[model samples]
Target: MRTLVIGDIHGGYKALLQVLERANVTKEDTLIFLGDYVDGWSQSAETIQYLIELSEKQQCIFIKGNHDVWCHEWLLNPEIENHIWFRNGGKETITSYLTNNFDTIAHLEFYKTLKNYYVDKKNRLFIHAGFSSMKGPANEVYLTNYRWDRTLWEMAIVMDKRVKKHSSLYPNRLKLYSEIYIGHTPTLHYDTDVPMQGINVWNIDTGAAFTGKLTILDIDTKEFWQSDPLPNLYPDEKGRN
Candidate 1:
């Protein structure tokens, strides 16, 4: 069985489908989603529906993202106008649900069931966002940081490349994992639209919510598949702008 890890989807349902088809996933495969499944694009409801259906048929691991958390809060209290969420594509998601009469209750439950992170037998860590105070997988000062922090990735990016010295200095930074996979912070921000790897940490959010493509990487083989650039798929979309 293969382990496929997908990056932030951000409501790009068409892109998500393309990546899945390109990856050729099967029932035996382990599907790991890095989250941000809602918000952005025009089909958040449809995206969640497909994900719910996919989970029923396969071994699926859903990691909660910051956007997902915002969505969860909004779902639980729709009367509270969350300006931040609404400005950042939440409006589109709500519209989709209202238009389709989607099952908000089931979707909310699905969100509640998502994990903040997952560690495989191999000690590979999968998280929506890396934590600033992540001493180890089991030690985090603020649990929500696991889905909202970008300091870990930033630290990894600026850390010295000397493997030995870097490891010695920040021994606990990512020492608990053989490798770390994260989303939330798009790789495109660093000028690359593909996964960025540094010191055993991999940033796989290729900014599919913006102009970048959706990416899926095989945890073992490291082989990856990407959907076409999102702007091409939805020409008039502003996505996460």
Candidate 2:
């Protein structure tokens, strides 16, 4: 029973499938997805439906992302316009529903069921983004931070490497978990298409929404697998590039 942490899918259902096959994933494996599952590619709605189906027979944990929050709100009240979301890949997501068979209510429920974050038996943290409190996510004052915060990752990047984990200078947040796995900030921004480790935090989002590929990393082995770039999988689509 392996635990696999997946990165931001960003509606690339094709990329999702390829990585699963490439990783040789099995039903016994636990899939902890870090969200941004919808938006970017041309199959946003299809991706959700597929996952909803996949979860029926596979062990899956879904984390809510910023994009997912926007998508859910729009589904609940389509008349309310979120121009920011629309400008950033939301338009493509809506078009995807039109192109596919969308069960509006079921999809909305699926979104509503997503967790803000998850802590495993090993005390490892799997979150879409980051939390603010030194006390950790459960005690976070602003839940939106769980989906939008970048400071956690920023802190990890800027931390002085010389500061040991046992040192007082070590971040409290880093000290809270045995290992932190996240996906809101793509590793591509840091100039790598593979997973990057900052302190003890591992960023698995390989920019599947844009030029990079989708990735799945085994939590135990630290080994990983990737699909072709989103553009290659959806050659006719721009995929938020």
Candidate 3:
């Protein structure tokens, strides 16, 4: 079975569908999503609803992103707004729920069930963001780092190429996994619109929240597919701006 890992969606349901279609994903495949499912464009609620239903039909692993945590908190207490979250795409997500007919109960449950991270039998690590511990994510001291950390990816990107994995200079955190996949920090930050591969860490968040396209990477083959730029898909909205 193919193992496909999807990147940060940021409420671009149209982009999600386009990437899945472009990738020709099958029910037999294992789909791993790197979260941030809501809080961006006009279809945040629809995206969550679709994912809830999709999980029932196929094998899917959903990692909780920082944005997803904020969205979940707001869902639990819709009345009292989290000002920080609201300023950063939460308003758009709330607006989607108000205008859409999604099942809030199921979506909330889905949020509750999201894994902070997932490790495949092949020893690949799938996380929304990064983990700081050398012992891996399971022993992470600050669980919030699973959704908010960027240091892991940062270290991977800047490591000296000459430092062999066996060398003491190599990072022990990265040494624990065969490969690591993450999506909190957008690749667009580095001016790329595609997945950024750093040693064994792959950053698949192609800035779908802003101007880049939604991306899906085939973990085994390293082949990937992307939707049209998110801005093009939702011309009328300013996603996560």
Compute the lDDT of residue 177 as modeled in candidate 1: 80
C-alpha displacement of 16 in model 3, angstroms? 0.4
lDDT by residue (tens digit), candidate 2, 119-215: 9999999999998899999999999999999999999988888999999989999999999999989888989999998899999999999999999
Q: What is the TM-score of each candidate against the true structure?
A: 0.95, 0.98, 0.98
- The residue ranges of model 1 lying beyond 4 angstroms of the native Cα positions read 165-167
| Tens digit of per-residue lDDT, candidate 1, span 1-241 | 9999999999899999999999998899999999899899998889999999999999999999988988888888888788989999999888877788768889999999999899989989999998765467467888888888888888788877775634558657767688999999988889999999977889999999999999999989899999999888889888987
Q: Which stretches of candidate 3 lie over 4 Å from their true place?
A: none
Supply the global lDDT for candidate 3: 0.93
RMSD of each predicted structure: 1.5, 0.9, 0.8
| Alpha carbon deviation, residue 103, candidate 3 (Å) | 2.1
Q: What TM-score would candidate 3 get against the native?
A: 0.98
lDDT of each structure?
A: 0.88, 0.93, 0.93
Steric clash pairs (candidate 1): none
